[model samples]
Structures are given as C-alpha cells and as structure tokens.
Target: MEPLLTAHNNEATSIAQLTAAQQKLYQWDKTIAAKHLYLIENKDTPYERLTTLKKHLAPLDATRQRDLIARYKALQTPPRGRRVEEWLRSWVEITNMCIAADVPETMGSRAQEDFLVACRTINPEYGTSGLRDLIDLEDAGTAIPSVEDYVSKFTTYLKRVLPLSTGLSSMAAELDVSKPQQQNKDGNKNGNKTKPQCPCGLKHY
Candidate 1:
C-alpha cells in the first residue's frame, strides 16, 4: 500500500510540473512555427527572415535589442552545466559571439572587467586568474561599472526587450549541469586522500 501510494503521489507531482512546463513549451513552439509558416506562406527568403527579425527588433531600445539577439542566439547554442563556472562560460561565449557578429556593443569593452569587479566585490578570494584571458580585454583601461551596475542595467534592458517575443518569455530557466566537479581516478568519490587544491584555491573533500 505504501509503495502504491508513493507511486501515485509521484505521478501527481510529475503531472503538475509537466503540465506547466508543457504549456510554456507549447506556446514557444507555436510562436516559432507561426513565424516559419508566415515566411513560407509569403515566399520569403532567408534574407527576408533576417530582415523581418531585425525590423521587429528595431523599435526596441538598443540594450533590449541586444538582449533579444542574445536570446535568439542562445536558442542556437543551448547551455550545458550545473556550476556558476558553466554559466559564466556560456555567458562569455554568447557575449563574445555577439561582439564578433557585430550585433551591438551594449556591454562595451569593460564587460569582463565589470564582472571581475563584481566578483571581487562579492568575495575577495573570488580572485580567479585567467578570467582576463577568457574574455578579450583590448580596452580595459576604460572606467567600466561594477557587476551590480551591469546587472541593474541588464535587467532593465531585458524588461524592455522581453515584450518583443511572440510568446517567448523574456526570461528562461536554464538547467545547470556544467558546474565543475572533482572526481577520483576510478570514478569513485574523492576518498580519504588529500586531493590537490583547484586552481581557484578551493579544496575538495
């Protein structure tokens, strides 16, 4: 009886979450499909598709447009990882791509600098080297704002841009599976040995 009740409870929980998630996913899928259908029905070319996206996005403020473009790009390259590092890596990649693609210089050259400032502000030991290397810092001397400032501005940007999506929410909840992990040689737990410290100086158990 206990096992049967547990199964029923689990099924109920799964159904509730799945229903909510599926509703959102279905809306997203329908929006994308409708865009494609319109293009096909109108016999629009790929250039037309890009033009439509650009025109649809043009009325938005510059920062908001940049955020929308980032979301569009993220649809192409979904993130993977569970750690903060994973999120950072994905952000760096996306930001760099946007920069390279000449989307718009919303973050400016001091984005990495700003992030470092935020990290330091949050925790001095957050001093992880190579962050500079990870991001291109050709112009670091400029006075970039702190991470908090960037987040505030970015949030404002997102709020302005989020309304552009046909059904896509301005916010997305990404699953984190890419956080860094320490594993033993044979895939066992870190065991009783005193493992070496990570480059970030964090000791593993």
Candidate 2:
C-alpha cells in the first residue's frame, strides 16, 4: 500500500487544511505505520517490551486506537467467501477506508457495488439472491434512504434469512448422504426424510 501520508501530502496544500475527519484518519494511519516501523527496527525485541512506544507518537484515545487497529487488519485481508456476514463486513471495511481517505463519494459507492457484484458472479445461485433482495427492498420504499441505511437494512435482512438459506441446507444434505439410507417396507430408501421442505418455498431446502 502506498503510504496514506504521502498521498495526502501530494493532494493537499497543507496538513492544517484537512477537515477534522481527514486529520483524525491521517493520525491513525501515521500511528499504525509508526508502530510497525518501530517493531521492524527493534527486530530482536518483543512488542511487550516496547515500553516507550506510545511516547514516540501522537496520543490517541484507547477505544479509537482499538477501532483503527481492527479496521486496519480488515483492510490487510482480501475479502473472501460468498457468506453474507463475511462479505458485508468486507464491503463495509472498503467503504470506511475510502471515507477515511476522503476519496470521492462516487468512487466509494462504485467500489462497494463492484464488490457485491463480484460476490454474485462467483456464486450466482446463492450470492445473486442477496444483491437482488437489496435492490427489491430499496425499490419498495424501504428504510434505505441513504447508502448507510442501505447497508444497515441489507445486513439485517441477510441475518434474518441466513438460517433458511440454501447454503446451510446443502450442508445438511451432504451430512445426510454420508449415513446409511434406511430401507422402507417395499425396499425403497426413505430419502424423503433427508431433505426437509423449506418453509419459505424459496429453494432454500
């Protein structure tokens, strides 16, 4: 990753001119970089022994530092899997990172949408449904009046429907297939019990 510090320096006239949110995000980036560099320089010493570490950098709130660290870690990991919860968290991370950097709103929006589309492409049957549902809900005058609201509502929908999703049902099918099939009175296997009827009738079984 190109250092965010240099990126801002090249784009802005001066650090003092940055907005409050921009300044806070810049400080976070600088702090994380500083900590990593310190560890590199003191390769022979353990992190726990770095007693004077914080003293060398600008002070940040404990809670904010923890949040920044978590966001930073999420950025370091590439988004993976078609799972709704996993994908949504990754999408949020990208959006937060773009916002922190003060990138154009359009750019951030496009990036988020692209990520969702990619997930759908990789798993059409399961993945496409989530994005489709999001659109449907948005068009129906639901609570998605803004991007933040859209994400929040979609996340809630994913959580509510996850239990009845085809992914879990498929896993159940695999487990059932592993066991010996019980024979019925006419010598036919009792296969009907293996796959339960999905209540929603949405092919989630």
Candidate 3:
C-alpha cells in the first residue's frame, strides 16, 4: 500500500494500481456512508443497516484509511477530487445533522411496514440500492439538483408521514382491547351473581 502511495508521486510510473485502489476505497466509503444515512433515515433498520456497513468496511486495511485521508486532503480545495475520506466525512456530517434534528424512530413491525409504504408512496425509487446510490452521488458532489434539494424534499415527506405512522400505531394499541374472560358456569365464585365488566370491557370478580 505504501508502495502504491509513493507510486502517485512518481511521474514515470503509470499509477494505475494506485488509481484502482483509490476507486475501491471510494466505493467502500460511499457504502459506509450510505448505510449510516439509511440507519438515520429508517430507524427501524439501524441494527441491520449498521451491521452491513461494518461488514463492508471491516476488510479495509489501515493503509487504505491513511491513503484515503491523504487523498481527501488533496480534494478539500477547489476542483474537488474524488476521494473516499472526504465523501465519508460528508456522510458523517449529514447523519449528524439528521440526528440533531431529533428524527423519530420507526419502532415495531407494523410501524416499520407503514413507514416503508410511506417512503414508497413519497418516492417510488427509494429502496436500499436507490437510496444508497443517491447518497453516494450526493456525498461525492456529483448529484444533479444538489444534495440539499434532494434532502429538503425527503425531509418534508418524512415529517408529514412519520406523525401519521406513529398515530396509527398508537391507535392500534389502544383499539386492540382484549376480550374479557368468561367464568365457568359450573364453578360460580359468588352464589349466582354475575361479574361486572370494567370500562375496558374486562370482567372482574
């Protein structure tokens, strides 16, 4: 890896190896960022999403992380270069911002299902792959209409649907009133008196 880094400094060498390595690093960084963003956006799948990111990024050596950092420094100035570290940092910032905004978590199976439905309704191309692709482009500064535009639209949609999703879950919990237990006719607790039903429709002795 050090050899590849030095290869970039050499004018004689083609640097093809270094370039390929950097590209792979960029893809990995993008994937990590996308997973974090997905976790932040779809809180229901945080564990699964984060696990995927860890799995993908685990294989990268320390040298790669260092190389990416150096490349990112180079891209920080104007005429930004495609660097893995810079993209990952951008993703981190975005995720932090979303977290700071206090986005609600999508809890429970029913809530998650409803959230997925809402996301699809808001944008047909919002599956994991599509979302990752968008996030990758946005982080790399290559996306059309700008990342801000895409995020603004997405945030607006989430704001509208999240409350409704939560409300539905709340309503479901409330309305699923459990039926009262029926006493055995043969075993009467009190002579012949019938049990009175509580406000929740549960019979109490």
Provide backbone clash counts, one per model: 8, 0, 0
Maximum-lDDT candidate: 2
Write one digit per residue (lDDT tens) for candidate 2, span 1-205.
3235434445676678776765665554455554355433432233432444555543544455555545544543334333445555655765665556544442434443544455453334444765676577667857433345545655554445454444422222333442558656454275454455677775565
State, as a TM-score between 0 and 1, how close model 3 is to the true structure: 0.20
Better of 1 and 2 by lDDT: 2
Off by over 4 Å in 2: 1-86, 102-108, 119-147, 164-205
What TM-score do all the candidates reach, one by one? 0.29, 0.32, 0.20
Q: Assess the local accuracy of residue 150 in candidate 1 as a C-alpha lDDT between 0 and 100.
A: 44
**Residue pairs clashing, model 2:** none
The 10-residue segment of model 3 with minimum total lDDT is 103-112
- Model 1 per-residue lDDT tens digits across residues 20-138: 54444333334544434343234224455456655665565577657757653443332332233343444555555555556643256444554544344223333244245334334
Quote the lDDT for 204 in model 2: 62
Q: Measured by TM-score, how close is model 1 to the native structure?
A: 0.29
lDDT for each of the candidates? 0.43, 0.49, 0.40
The full ranking of all candidates by lDDT, starting with the best, is 2, 1, 3
